[model samples]
Target: MTDHSLYVLLRKLEDAKIPFTLARDRPDTIRVTMHLVGERTEIDVFDDGHMEVSRFCGAEDIVGDEALVDRLIQENRD
Candidate 1:
């Protein structure tokens, strides 16, 4: 996200007293992770001011792209 948007988001989180951790920070993107309501949530902010949010219910909730899934299945085939 743009610097302004990232700043605003961090400010809001601080104002709300929500605890979060920085998973990654780079020139092109920033990743924030937090736990809420017993679930893990992740937010990725891009330099273009675009954002994506993902929530995982558990370990089983993690997933990959179709190609990755296919590879995993093939590797495990009997």
Candidate 2:
């Protein structure tokens, strides 16, 4: 089975009630788009664990630091 870690990560967004979608495709190449509080953006994560973050708006308005975002994105299965 494919690792459920990413799917699990996506599920956390559900409790937050953030809208998202999962498709059957190569993950690293998959494009994810999101709008957080009217800010438009997209993020594509690479195989090396690096992400390309783009924001049409609202990047500057993010609260806290990168560490917070990292913590939120990490899905702990233990």
**lDDT of each prediction vs. the true structure?**
0.79, 0.59
Candidate 1 regions exceeding 4 Å error are: 1-3, 25-27, 58-78
Which tens-of-lDDT digit does each residue in 1-78 have in candidate 2? 444444444556677787755333464655456657667556564555455667776445558798887887786535
Model 2 residue 28 CA deviation (Å) reads 4.8
Off by over 4 Å in 2: 1-8, 21-28, 58-78
Best by TM-score: 1
Q: Which candidate leads the pack in lDDT?
A: 1
Candidate 1 Cα lDDT to native: 0.79
| Cα misplacement distance, residue 14 of candidate 2 (Å) | 2.4
Candidate 2 local accuracy as lDDT?
A: 0.59
Candidate 2 lDDT score at position 18: 73
Which run of 10 residues does model 2 get worst, by summed lDDT? Answer: 1-10
